[model samples]
Target chain A: MLEARVYVIMKPGVLDPQGKAVKSALDSLGFEGLKDVRVGKYFAIKLDDISKEKAMERLKGMCEKLLANPVIEDYKIEILDIKS
Target chain B: MLEARVYVIMKPGVLDPQGKAVKSALDSLGFEGLKDVRVGKYFAIKLDDISKEKAMERLKGMCEKLLANPVIEDYKIEILDIKS
Candidate 1:
């Protein structure tokens, strides 16, 4: 089995209201050091008996197809530990 | 500078509507062998000259204060590498 870790973030220049809301909330709560809070999505998946390349391909397809909004978001994937 | 990696996941037993929607979409797209799609959040932060413990305390505060919805999510933090 292999584990895939996926991260999806808003594309540069895209407005992230959620992130902004959080940043404002933080500022109000006295956390003055935080700036540019960009909210993102994360996913962890376990695949059975698949080669890393094929699994990554399928995972990327999943991201592009449904996991992310390509018009406003960009994504990156990292493969964590793999176990047989 | 130190790097912080925060992972916030929906509490177990909480219904993840987004995850379910993604799962169904994947099924429709003919990607079989996938189940239990849990969605989460990831953050990568660069902290300046802060002790690891202090940084963690403040980061945890941020998670509890703004980054996570305490009612439905739980978070874990990983201090990646620290460089002086």
Candidate 2:
């Protein structure tokens, strides 16, 4: 089995309203030293036994086709562990 | 300045409908070697100059108060970088 983690985040120029809301909430709550906040998505996946190279390739496919929106978001994949 | 990343995930026993939906979507998309999928939230935060220890402490507060729900989710914080 193989396990992988994917992180999906908005591109630098994109506006993130949720993150903005969080920043303001924190500010009201008295938290200091805050400059910016951005929110994204995380996914942990389990897959049948596969080579690391193959897993990476498959993950990329999944990210492009379904997991992330290429227009405004970027995704990164990390293969966490493999077990036979 | 300090940059930190936070990962929020559902507790192991919690239901993740979004992950299930993704898994089914992938299954229908003809991708093979699938087992399971779980989805979560990611946050990237930038802060004004602060010590690593202080940053961590403040981040935990934010997570507890606004970032994550303690009832069903767990959060992990990583101090990505700090620059003066």
Candidate 3:
């Protein structure tokens, strides 16, 4: 089976409270050098009989339509081998 | 600035309702060749002066403690260049 790794993140200028909380937690934990952090969603999609080219097309369509909210989030998709 | 990409996914055999919901949506949309789908959380963490080794350690600690549920999810962390 082939796999697609889809990453969906909030737009650069958007506020991310979850990420901010994480950074604050890191600060309280005494970890240093943290500049910023952003949180997002990842989806690993398994396909049985699709070619890589077609899979890419379909995955992009999936993102633009359902997996991501284009008004606030940007998404990326990566094709991966079966073992992943 | 260095960055880290952390991917957190449910372990194999762990029930995933979100993925199932997505798969069903795809099915309804007339897309085929899908075997399975898994959903996860991805974090892009930026650091100013931390080395790759140390960043990894801290990120892993963060994952085990807060970013992920150690009992049900597995996470992978990647060090990234600043531009990423």
Ten-residue segment with the worst summed lDDT in candidate 3 chain A? Answer: A75-84
Best by lDDT: 2
- Measured with C-alpha atoms, the lDDT of residue A66 in candidate 2 is 95
Ranking by DockQ: 2, 3, 1
- Listed per prediction, chain B TM-scores read 0.92, 0.94, 0.93
Clashing pairs in 3: none
For B1-84, candidate 2 gives per-residue lDDT tens digits of 889999999999999999999999999999998999999999999999878899999999999999999899999999976546
The DockQ values of the predictions, listed in order, are 0.51, 0.91, 0.84
Residue runs of model 2 more than 4 Å from their true location after superposition: none
Task: Return whichever of 2 and 3 wins on TM-score.
Answer: 2
Per-residue lDDT over A1-84 for candidate 2, one digit per residue giving the tens place of the 0 to 100 score: 899999999999999999999899999999987899999999999999888999999999999999999999999999976546
The numbered model that scores best in TM-score is 2
The sequence of per-residue lDDT tens digits that candidate 3 reaches over residues A1-84 is 787899999999999999999889877887778899899999999888678898999998889888999999999989987663
lDDT of 3 by residue, B1-84 (tens): 888899999999999999999999988888888899899999999887677888889888988888899999999999986663
Which rank order by lDDT, best down to worst?
2, 3, 1
Q: Can you tell me the CAPRI class of model 3? A: high
